[model samples]
Structures are given as C-alpha cells and as structure tokens.
Target: MKYCYYILSVSLLILIFSCDDKVDLEQFIDDSEELTLVYSSISPQDTILKVRVLKTLSSDNNIEINNSDAFVIPNAVITLSDATNNSVRLSYNSDDKNYQIEATQLEILPGATYFLSVMVDQREFTSSCTIPNNAVTELAFELTDNLNNAGDLKESVTIRFLDIPEASNNYIVGARIEDDAFDLFLDFENRRFITDQIEDGALLASFGFFNNNPDSVTDITLQVANVEPILYDSLFASYSNKENRQNPFYEVIIPPNNIEGENAYGVFAGFQITERLITYQ
Candidate 1:
C-alpha cells in the first residue's frame, strides 16, 4: 500500500514556498528525493518515545500535507540506545503513525548520550545527541513595562536564573499560559537561546520576556530547557534563520540536521526541562 508520505521536516518548509515562483521551485522539486527523515526528542518527564519518520515529497504534489496520514512511514525498524548500552526497539502505532517505546526502560538523563537508528528502504540512517546536566540553579520572574516602537507602554516579563556552567552550557527559556484562555501564543512562547560564553560558573543570567498579552491576568508557566550543544546549535539555526523558510526573495536556509546518512535531515535530541508556574495579575 503506497501512502502519501510528506517528510515532516521538509513538508512545512515546502508548503511555505508552494505559491512562490514556480520556475525556481521546479528545480527544487526535481531535485527532491525520497529521503528518510527522523525527528525525535526525549525527556525523562515523558512516558513514551514519539518518533516520526517520513519521506520527502515534491512541491508540485497536490496532496494535503496536513492530513493525519499525509506522510507517515509505517512498520519501520527503529532502535534507541543510551551510553550505558541500554537500548529499546520501538514499535509502530498506526493510530498516531509514530514509533514508540512503551516499556519505559530508557531513562533520558543529563550528561547521557543517545543514539537512534532507523532501517527504511534498505538504508540505515543514524543520529546521536547528548543530554546536558541541569544548569539552572534558581529561577524568578518579575513584571515590567517597556516602550515599543510606537512609544506605547507594553507589558513584558523579567526572568532571572542562576547558572552552573556545564561545558559551554546553552539554554532556551520561555513562558506560556497554563490554560486555553489566550490563543495568541503557543503553549511555549518567548523562546530565546543563550550560551555561557561570557558568563562563567555560578553566573547570574537575566533577560526580558516577550509577552504578547499586554495587560491580561493569567497563570503562566516558565520553562527552562537544558539542551545539548549539538541540539542547541541546530535549534539556534532554525530559530535564527526562520525567515529563510519564508520570504520569497531570500534563499531558504536548511536548518542543521544531526542525522548521519545520505539525503536525510533532522535531529535526535534530548531535553531536560524545569518549569515553574507564576500567577500574574
């Protein structure tokens, strides 16, 4: 059974360019290949491993990529192993179209390395990532007001955290409303990545939060994620170069993918997130 498989990693970017210049897109479409894409991120807080595998599609294809079954690769052999040689092979769940490890034997811990391998179409592709030790010692938030470009008072948040350097530690912080009150922002917003290049051990880090709601009162959860160096670099590229995926005038930037193999892109990352809920009025 041949299913319409749109690689999730590549599909989102391709759709942004579908209505743009067809002449340029023709070359990209023609150059497209059926590459095996692997995207998985694991954390100890989560119960099961959710891995997505898909094949790339052409820009000219009319299949709706948003369809639940749009680009799912079924019944692929997938395995994940940690540095201590604790490994678990995943089984495919047709309902969610994701490869999952149900036994929960794998522990995603800081300073641990994880390797993921996928067997598809007679090709074996692999990617590895390490989990960084917890760097956030303490976290506190304060409300503040800032003047936007229009000279109007805008609400913002001030976040402060104590850091413990862990081999060039990199961090991404953000906040989101706990409930479904505001549809303006995603569950996680105000995303920013920072490194301890300037601030060393026992350093104090502070930054202003990017809040969309000006005067709204709600409960917001702050997220502090300790991302590995490799994964940090890839996310940094994806976050910084987001415009490359859009704007028709500039060439799209292919966000760094840690996967190792021919014609494949994506990351197998591990994250340790610490959250604190704050009531703001």
Candidate 2:
C-alpha cells in the first residue's frame, strides 16, 4: 500500500522546498504529544493542489506510520474560502492520498489572503495567510574568490528585495545550490526568519553554498516567502526552543500553531513565494 508521505523534521526544523530531512515518524509517536496535524500551503504556480491530515501514534502502537489504517484521515470536509465568502470544497483523492481540488477548478489570486477549514469527525481545524506580492526590485548572485573558514573555495548569492510594505511584514528565506539529484542547502543559517519592523525600506540577505569545483555546480535557487506574522512567530519560536532543548533548566516548549481547535496542531499557511534561479558564474 502506498501513502502520501510528507516529511516534517522536528530535529532539523525544515519548513519546505530544497531540503532533505530524514526522520522516522514513528519515533515521534509519544502519547503526550499526540494530535492531528493538518499541513497545507498554497501557491498560484502550483500544478497540483495538496494537503496533509495525519494523526500521531501512541507509544504502545507498533503499526508502521505510513501503512497504518488509523494514521490517515480519509474522511474530511476540506474547504478553502476567501474573505468575500467564496469557498471550494476539496475531496480526499486516494490516488494522491490528500484532500485536493484541481487548480483548474479555482482561480487563486496572487498576494491575496485566504482561509482553510478542515473538518474531521466532530472537530474542525482552521487557519489562513496572505500570499506576498513578490515585488522584488533587485535579486543578484555574487560569487567571491575568498575561501571560507574551512579553507574550501565557495560561492555566495545575495538577494535585495523590495520589502513588502505592510504594518507587520515577516519573511522566510531559503537558498540552496543544486546539480541534478544532489542539493547543497546553505546551512548554519538555512531558512532565516526575519521581520521588517526595524527596516526603513527594502531588505537584503545573503547565503553561501559549497562549491570547491565551480563546474560541479549547475544552478542556485532562492525561495523567498512573505509568510504570515503568526506563522513567522511559530517558526521562530520552534527553532529558538531547539537550541535550549538540551538545557535541564529550560521548560519544554511546543511551538504554537495557527490552527484553532481541540486536538489540532500544525500550520495551514500559504506561501507567496518568489523564486530566482542563477546559473553558476
């Protein structure tokens, strides 16, 4: 039996795209942290719509996470709605193992806010986010001749984006170097969560990727998302807590969720993503 497996790594705290994080879902089956995880993200550029609804397992359960009968939520009343109250009902497609509606069925507006409601059994989960306008003024990749601390020669990319002018604007930036199946994500600072609270205007960020042999690199991808402020806070707190998790003095902190309901835990946020690809120079 095949199941739609979406990997969410608690240890690495990976959000999405250009990442390869490995973790056994069964290992996180502690009864204490058990809950329903409804994860979804929307983009106008998507070719297929997808969403995940999963139930965590108990410590005593020996069933495999993927093939478990009770793991996936087969019956769900999934709906996506806008502020004006237009809604689209999504059905569980067993072929893809997710509740989805074809992209052709609905017209999604760029930089527009939308809401998600997932009804499972007697409970309902809800969350929403605004897609960013993605008006980037300047996006350039810079490669330097200087060697990194490891003495390995490498290249870096710098992005200067016209900040989304909002009262409370927040973003998640990710960069990775790729060549076919192999991907080298810029670590030590992967997926930097930032805000424009202190900014006067526009923002700039940079990341370096391993490139001992420049010919081995093909292209670099930069994914910049103007995520919701609520989603921004949750992601920031989650990674911050990871640093202190080993400290005996610190209390365990479960990252806050935007989804509102009993036994509902996870994010249903949309991404207004602006991706730029730069060929190795």
Candidate 3:
C-alpha cells in the first residue's frame, strides 16, 4: 500500500509538469503576428519628389514571408502643394526606388510655400516649408591705396542672412555680380563660404582687398543652397572673368524663421582697403 501511494505521488508530479509545459506552448501559439510600414520623403520642399518605403518585422514569431527583401510599391501615390495652395499628384517611378513629381506641375516659385505628403502601405507622412524668397545681400570689395585702415580691412565684405544656427546645421553663402553690361555669377565651388555652430556668428561673405581689383564692386546675393535660383548661372560662370558691377547694390535683412529667432542675429557687412592694385609692372 505504501509503495502504491509513493508511485501515485510521483505520477501526479509528472502530470503537473506536463500541464505547465502545454500551457506555455498554447500561450506561444495564441500570440498574433504584427506588421508595420515606414515611409520617408527625401525632398520635402521641392515638387521633384523622392520617397523611400520600408516594411519591418514587428513580431517574434517565425513568419514564412520574405521580410529580408524590400517590396517595391509601384503604385504609391504622392502629392505636392505650392505656395499658392495648389496641389498636384505624383506617380511612382518604376525604374527606381522613389516616386517623382514633375517640376512643371507645381509651378515652383520663389518665396512660395510648399508641402509634400506621401502615402505608402496605408501610412502617410508630410512636411512643409515656405519657399524662401530670393533674399541676397550685396558685397563689394573697395580697395584704397592707403594702408593705415585697420578696422575697415578687418570687416567682412560678404553679407548674408542666417536661417538656422543649431550645432551641425549647414548654411550656404552665395555672391553674384549684376551690372547693366554684364550679369556675372561668382564661382561658389571655388569661392563658396561655409560656417558651423562651432564658428557661431551672423552669415557673412568676406573678400580681402589684398587680392587686387581696386575698382571692382561685387553685387552679392545669398539664398538657401540647393533649392532654387541656380546659385551659379552655369558651371562656366563659376570660373568666368566677368567684371563686378556697381550701383543698385543689393541688401536686405531677413528675419529668421521661428526656429532661428532665439539666438542673437545680425547682418555683418564691411569692407577693407588693402594694397594698391598692381598691373604686373
């Protein structure tokens, strides 16, 4: 009788362990698989739209579908709105990973507001920007024969407006010379100036009188880089010898957007008189 009772207790213990194991298995089976989709708009401000879609694994269960591969949505729809509140639809480009909208459809204009909205996998994301007006300040280097001028020479000749000043934010300063005789664009690639938060200050472009060209007056203009109004007229103008123009000097003070308004901002514009222009005497 004693042996039978011990055997029965062991059997009960085994049954309890087996039931617990089964319960865990059922819990695992009851869990549901989850799916998520992500979308990004590369050019949020321009009508020439670009978007990337990604589908990610959201569940721990082993699913049979190929999650490693990126499924292209050929029929994804995109829309862009202009500053005038007009919106146009864009079609997906089958040849690439993005959907492109025609620039002509939006009638991209300077100082116009714009926004981009993308739909992928039933999820939507959007961004907006007021197309910056053509805000450029003119800079000219006036060389004087006198060498006693110190403060004037130390001053920055190029004047520009800062849109943002957070660390790692990049700003582009551009200059163009426009005269009735010649409309010249400076070589920004060879002459473009860039500043970072580490070198915090108002946006400026500087040219020293020490480089010669005493009478040259540079008509300067500054705009946000890569968005509109081709910074350099052409690749050739980047290195051309077009003479600087005088009169109708360009200057404007742009109030920073809300994001950039907190910091102290001012326009730094000045010129220095250096050595006389030498003609290879």
Candidate 4:
C-alpha cells in the first residue's frame, strides 16, 4: 500500500500528552460496581455512528474478558437524542459488538447539540456534544519538494483554507493517497490540531508539512474535520496512551469524557467534515 501523510503540529502533540487516557491500568478500580467503559463519536457525514461499551477489567476476569463474547456487553441499550429532542435507540449487533444507529435516524445538524445515553446492567451513561458550524472553504493544495529555512530537501503539501470565527475550535486534516493499485489511509498519528486563537475569525489558515515519505504519495484526497473539543481531548488522551506503550514509565490512561457520570469513560462527539481531492503532478 502507498502512504497517506498527516502533518502533525506541536499543539496536537501537547493535547495527546495532556488528556486522560480512555483505557489504562488506573481505571481498573477495586470497587465492586463494574465501571462502564463507553466510546462513541458521531458526525453528520457518517452513515453509521457506533458506540463500543465494555466493563472495566478485573484481575480475575481480565483474561476472560479478552475473549470476544466475554468482553462485549450483550443487549446493551444505547439511545441517541437529536437536536429536536427526539431519541433513537441503537441496536447491538453481536457480530460487530457495537451499538449502532443509522446516521439518517439521528438527523445531525450543524450548531446543534446531540445527546447519547447507554443503559448497561441498569447503569445509565450519558454524554452530549455540539456540532461545530463550519466547513473547509476554498480548500486547495500544492505539492513541492522545496528547501525550507533549514535548507533541507523537504517534500510537502500546502493546505490552505479559511477559518470560521466561532467560540474556540479544533481542526484535523487527513490525507488518503492513491498510488498505482493501492490506496493508503493516513495514520492518526499524523493528525494536527488547528486553533483560531490569534485571528479569532479574521484569518486565513494554512497547514503544510514536510512529507515523511514523499515517494509513496502520488494522488491524495484530503478530509478536513471541525472536531468538538471533547472529542479532540478524548482522542488526545486515548492516542497518547497507545503511542507511549513502549515507554517504561507509562502513565495510567486518563479516562475519556463520559458525561453520564464522573467515573464514566468514553466519548460522544460530533464532527463537520469537508473533503477535496488533489492529484500529485
């Protein structure tokens, strides 16, 4: 497969290191009540929104939980309420082990908030997030192998767009490159966060980066997403924990934002996405 590149920024790295991990050893509390683990994210652009629900692992049952059926919570009731206050319950597909609801049923709208609730063993997990009102405008790109200020040979793509002035917003741009018969999806590690602090709402934003593997990119399709802060924070913590697995001093995973309760873990997020395709010449 060819390579899809995501240019990472310093702020994104900071977020990943800052948030709490969704899955980590610290969450394995000794309490008799099994803490419910939840993960879900939704977008108007998605056809199906899925939520993964699981119980915190215990010392004795940790091995057992590793089995597919043993870990998955069967018949869990997952409900999603739309901006109109209408609710749609997600059905559990035992085959996929996820609670799923069709996107059309949710009626995801811009600038609207959506709520998610899960009933597991009589425990109710609830969380809410608003969809940001913005889309990638004038999205265009150009590839170059030009030398930077450091005078090193750098192959990069210049991604330019307009930032909508809203409360504070975070953005991630990803590229899937097609070369020969292979289609390579960009790795999440390459995701960068775009913040609108300085310009407020008046600035043109451009994100560009040196290609890590230039030869692997021939044609690319870029997906720019305006992500909710909670979603961004959750991914930061979750991905950070996964990336630091090789380190000896691994910090416990910080639990994700589960609005259901303080100890609840996982994300209920929304994204507004815009896509553009550019072929490398």
lDDT of 3 by residue, 159-228 (tens): 3344333333333334333334443333333333344435554554433222223134444332334222
lDDT of 4 by residue, 1-281 (tens): 22221111112222212111122322243455545667676667777777777655445544532354545677788888976779998888877677787788878778788888888767777888788886656576666554554686656666667787656777766655665544334433423456676777654444445334445666666666778887777656656655776899988566456567644656677777777877666
Whole-model lDDT, model 1: 0.62
Best by lDDT, which number?
Answer: 2
Q: Candidate 4: misplaced stretches above 4 Å? A: 1-33, 62-70, 146-154, 177-183, 187-191, 202-219, 244-256
* Model 3 regions more than 4 Å off: 1-47, 57-72, 135-169, 172-281
For lDDT, candidate 2 versus 4, the one ahead is: 2
The lDDT values for all models are: 0.62, 0.63, 0.33, 0.61
**Model 1 clash tally?**
2
Query: Distance from true position, residue 264, model 4, in Å?
Result: 2.0
Which residue pairs in model 1 clash with each other?
Answer: 5-71, 6-71
Model 2: lDDT to the true structure:
0.63
Candidate 2 per-residue C-alpha lDDT over 190-215 given as tens digits, one digit per residue, 9 for 90 to 100: 33666677874656564555534446
Model 1 C-alpha lDDT per residue in residues 1-281, reported as the tens digit of each score: 24333445432211111111111111223443566667777766557776778766654577565653656679689999988788999999887577887536787777778899998877888988777666475678777776654576656666667666546666766655544454432212223566677867754443443334534546766666666665666655654444255566875545568889888777777766666778878
Instruction: After the best TM-score superposition of candidate 1, give how far the Cα of residue 99 lies from its true spot, in angstroms.
Output: 2.9
TM-score for candidate 4, please give it.
0.71
Pairs that collide in candidate 3 are 83-113, 136-222, 138-220, 153-272, 158-205
Query: Which numbered prediction scores highest in TM-score against the true structure?
Result: 1
Model 2: residues >4 Å from true position, as ranges? 1-16, 20-34, 63-71, 91-97, 133-137, 145-154, 176-178, 181-183, 188-191, 211-215, 241-253
Worst 10 residues of 2 by lDDT: 4-13
Worst 10 residues of 4 by lDDT: 5-14
